[model samples]
Target: MDTAAYALLVFGALAGGFVSGLAGFGTALMALGIWLYVLPPSLAVPLVLICSVVAQTATLPSMWRSFDFTLIWPFIVGGLAGVPVGTLLIAHADPQIFKLGVGLFLLVFPTVLFFNRTPMAFRFGGKVADAGVGFAGGVLGSLAGLSGPLPILWASLRGWGKDERRGIFQIFNWTVLLAALCYQAATGLIELKVIWLALIAFPGTIIGASLGTRLYHALSDRNFGDVVLGLLFLSGVGLVWSTLGLR
Candidate 1:
């Protein structure tokens, strides 16, 4: 990659990583902008895995105490089961449709909680729900390198506030991202240039995720939810545009 592209990735790494740490799921949106600037979407998804995984690892220890392994593990299993399916669909399907679908889905994801009369009782969202969310995460993740919103929404609906919610997101993001990364690597989609960019971006993500863990107290629960929703909306629009080949 050229200096200009590398530079953009560097800036994206620091900014996105910090946001993810603070907000819980902005890294994908942040990196999407820079990745689009430097490469095609197809190439960007695999590259993002490299950076996302590092950020997740960095933030893991801080959030470990807050983790609900029972909740997370089911999703991980489902995500693993779904990644290949998502990858296969992505490999041959039309990109524009994926964008529109994801955009629409994201736009709706955060709103469901606002209007729903009955919330999901604990028992209602059990192993099946976790697996369902995980499968969705893997599918979207493989398609757009974005899959954080679903899990975030699930947590939000459960009355999980800012800090813990972000922690869950960090862990979940890494799970799906690392899984996808492994798939991409096995399939030879990850190029040398992608690895080069990853090397430069990883440290930035690590630092930012660390800082986010420290600054988790700064944001209010309402604000955290709002920001996450807004970012998802904006990122959704961006993804739709990308689907249309506009970005």
Candidate 2:
């Protein structure tokens, strides 16, 4: 890669890592945005996957105490089931259209929640609902390297506490992202260029994640929720812009 591409990759990694560390998600949204400016989607997507795994693993220890298998298993199972389907669609699906539809939903859903005066305690989704959300996440994960947004929105709407919500976000993302990585590897989508970029971006990932972890600790639950929503909104906007072929 050229010097400009290398710089953009490093910058993307740091920015993406910080968001992932703070919010337990968003590496692809942040990093891929920058990477796509300098590299093709083929290279950009795999690089984001590798760095996302790294960022997620880095922040896992901090969130380890919040892990709850009983609450998370359904989503995991559903997400796993959806990956192959998404991978299959990767070759045939119209990504721009798919992304545009998801982006609009994400943008609108959060806005409505933000403006609602009486935010009801909405904690009535059984495992089935959770599994459904997970399946959607899996499809998105495979199709766009974006599995966190749907689950994040679900947790937020369910009125989960910070730790509980983060447990779902961190663990769900790690599982789906790792699964996607493996699938890509098996299909030979992960090339040596992706690996080289990952190595070049590793240090930025560590630094950004460390800083974000510290920031995460300082925020109140309400503030953290707001931050997550804000990031999700930005992610939606980014998706829309990208799909329009504007950047």
Candidate 3:
């Protein structure tokens, strides 16, 4: 890679890693925005998955106390089931339409929530609903390395505490992303060049994630919620702009 591409790659890794470490999810949301400018989707998609797994794994210990298998298994089961289906559909799906739909939802939903100031903790759907959200997350994860948003939104609506929400984001995304990466490898998307680029991204991801994890420990629950919502809003903007060629 050229110097410019290398710089962008590392910058993307740093940004994405920091967000993942801080929020327990968002590596792809942050990284793909920059990486796509320099790397093709095939390479960038799996790279984000790998880096996301790395960032999540690195910070897992910090969120370990919040882990509850009973609370998370439904999502995992649903997400795993969705991955191969996503792989099959990618070839037929229209990328632009998909981006526009997700981008608009991210834009509108987060904006409304950010301003509402009402704590929304709904208990209506239960575990089945959570699994359905996980299935959607898995499909998105495979399509664009985005398995966090749906579950994140659902957890927020469920009014989980910061650590509880982060736990879902971390463990759920780790499971889904790792599964997506494996599917990509099985389908030959993990090329030698992608591996080389991942090597280049490693140190930046580690450093950024380390720093972000430190900051995460200092934030209040309210502050953490605002930060996550803000990032989601910004991610929405990035997606819409890039998809519409306004970037």
Candidate 4:
């Protein structure tokens, strides 16, 4: 690759890894725009998935004490069950319209939450509600590779603390992204070129992820919430931009 492409690749990986480490999600949201400028969607998308898994795994050890299996299992179960359903739905769905709708939701919902600092106090439905959000996230993930928004939004609305929110979404993202990576591998989407690109990107991902984890340790609860909201807002912009590009 030329120096410009190489630089963009490293920069994208760094940004993606940092966001994932700091917020428990958003690797693709931060990286894909830059990567897409240099690589085809075929290569850029899988590379985002691979780097995301790497970033999540690399930073997880720091949050090991906060790992709550009882809290996260329902979401995982619901997500796994929903993936096949989503895969089926993709056959009948209009992908661009689906992305546009999700893009709009991401834009409006986060803007509302950003303005309203008071967290909602509704605590009903317990794990069942969590699972339902996970199921929707899984369907979204399969449909548009967008599994983070619903659960993350639910966590915010439920008034979870920073660590608790991170614990839920981080582990959940790791599981879902890893599963998707494996599916790609099984289906022969992970080719030698992707491997080579990953090799180019891995160093930046690791370094950026490590730096982001340190920053995460420094954030107060309110500040962390702001960061998460900011990322979501940016994700909305990216989604809307991509959807509009199709027209």
**Per-candidate local distance difference test:** 0.74, 0.86, 0.89, 0.83
Write down the TM-score of every candidate: 0.86, 0.95, 0.97, 0.91
* lDDT (Cα, tens digit) per residue for candidate 4, span 97-155: 87578778889998999999676855879999999988887777654456788889898
Candidate 1: TM-score? 0.86
Which numbered prediction scores highest in TM-score against the true structure? 3
Estimate the TM-score for candidate 2. 0.95
Overall local distance difference test of candidate 3: 0.89
Model 2 Cα displacement at 216 (Å)? Answer: 0.7
Give candidate 1's whole-model lDDT.
Answer: 0.74
Candidate 3: list runs displaced more than 4 Å: none
Off by over 4 Å in 2: none
Best-performing candidate as measured by lDDT: 3
Tens-digit lDDT string for candidate 2 (1-247): 7888789889999999999999889898788778888988788877887888899999888879877878788889989998888888888987678879988887998887777646556766688899999999998887778989898888877787788788898899899989998998999878887887788999998788888888998989888888888888888898889888875
Ranking by TM-score: 3, 2, 4, 1
Error of 3 at 84 (Å): 0.8
Q: Ten residues in a row with the worst lDDT in model 3?
A: 62-71
Best of the two (1, 4) by lDDT: 4
Which candidate model has the greater TM-score, 1 or 3? 3
Residue 46 in candidate 3, Cα distance off native in Å: 1.0
